[model samples]
Target: MLWTHKILWIATLVSAFAFLGMTVDSLHRMSASTHADQLSAQVIEGKRVWQHYDCNDCHTILGIGAYYAPDVTKSYSQRGAPWLRKFLENPAAMYPSGRQMPNFHLSSAQIDSLVAYLGWVSRIDTNGWPPSPEGVTPAEDAQRAAGGELAGSKIYLAQGCNACHTIQGSGGTIAPDLTHVGSRRNKSWILAQINDPRRINAQSVMPSFAQLPESAKQQLVDYLDSLK
Candidate 1:
């Protein structure tokens, strides 16, 4: 009888634990039930807009989704809020040479929410990802600070330069390793190469920066110059 009673006690305890687990799950789900009640509404709404527009079908985020477009998760630190907003308004205006991302014609309210959402997404602790701060500065601002030209480390990503090049053993290997390039080339040499690639290497696969504004060129150059 004592053995049977102990067995019954064990069964009861198991049942109680199961009930507690269910209750905790219910509370979690309930807390996440409403969008407005979510931890970050801007992120939620931004996710909503992202899904509604099927952006993943074209672009990747957090290393998931399609590769046809640039990864946007790093845009905050790379492009900053202003450039991101402007790009959303008109992609062609920002990069005449690049493929177009259609203007969504989002309302002011929607834009605000989107910007907030992007900011929230940007803070999602990627464990010091992208390996760089991807400094915040306009192309013009970086150029003036660097004097002749900005290192343009960010330009490597912005111009899709990494699509063909590698950096610090990361990125594609199709082009070249650019991490220690600054040590190899002077500012004038770098400027001349970027401004007129054909002049240095007639058969070079890299694109010319002639079309890019001098300010943007300087910003990119500055970013590249900063790379180790």
Candidate 2:
């Protein structure tokens, strides 16, 4: 009985030590993985802003919070600063249809701070979490290679145009709907818009995507021009 008790005590100690060691190792690595040293003062304020409005109640970040809205963990990287700024400024204008994020009427400073904070959050190493559950392929780099998806459509998706423009009843509504844009605008006009939106409309809030490869620009233009 005494020896059995001693064995149990030794096993418990070993297991406890193993758990403690692993916890310590994880904590040590977390700082590097999350880039904690980059947590700037603006970022902290952004976090405060996020909490001040209870954004978690409607959206999820880092896979924590309600699932009612889209996960914003990677939204910063996916949407880009310009798009985010536009959307944050007017959530209703961005998504006129479907579930709408209320117009918080947040001040410009607040919006900038929140954007900066989200930027930091997006940089954290999440080890490829929040996988695309609706997609056919699990591989990140696997571009609909086997599917019959259009090359132009693929380019549009890759460029994140859906962040502002609605196409075929899908995508964001912040910008003009492209469901029938082909019928309204010519190919040259579409190309110009892609290269520099401000050229067409001085008041256009849309950012220029002139940096995209020439081939990609043509492909994207083809996709947008075919939305008839």
* Candidate lDDT values, in order: 0.68, 0.81
lDDT of 2 by residue, 1-228 (tens): 699999999999999999999999999999999999999999999999999999999899998999899889988876667657777888864455567888999999999999999999999999889666565544533554433235677667655678778787888777888888888998899999888888979988676677767876787777667767
Model 2's TM-score against the true structure: 0.68
lDDT of 1 at 96: 44
TM-score of each model, paired residue for residue: 0.46, 0.68
RMSD of each: 9.8, 5.4
Summarize candidate 1's per-residue lDDT along 1-228 as a digit string, tens digits.
699999999999999999999999977765544333434676677778878888898988776899898777777766567556656766654544435678788776666667777676666555565574445657766665566434455455666566556678776565568888777877677778877777977887565556666877777666666565
Model 2 worst lDDT run, 10 consecutive residues: 140-149
Per lDDT, the best of the predicted structures is 2
* Model 1 regions lying over 4 Å from their true place: 1-39, 128-228
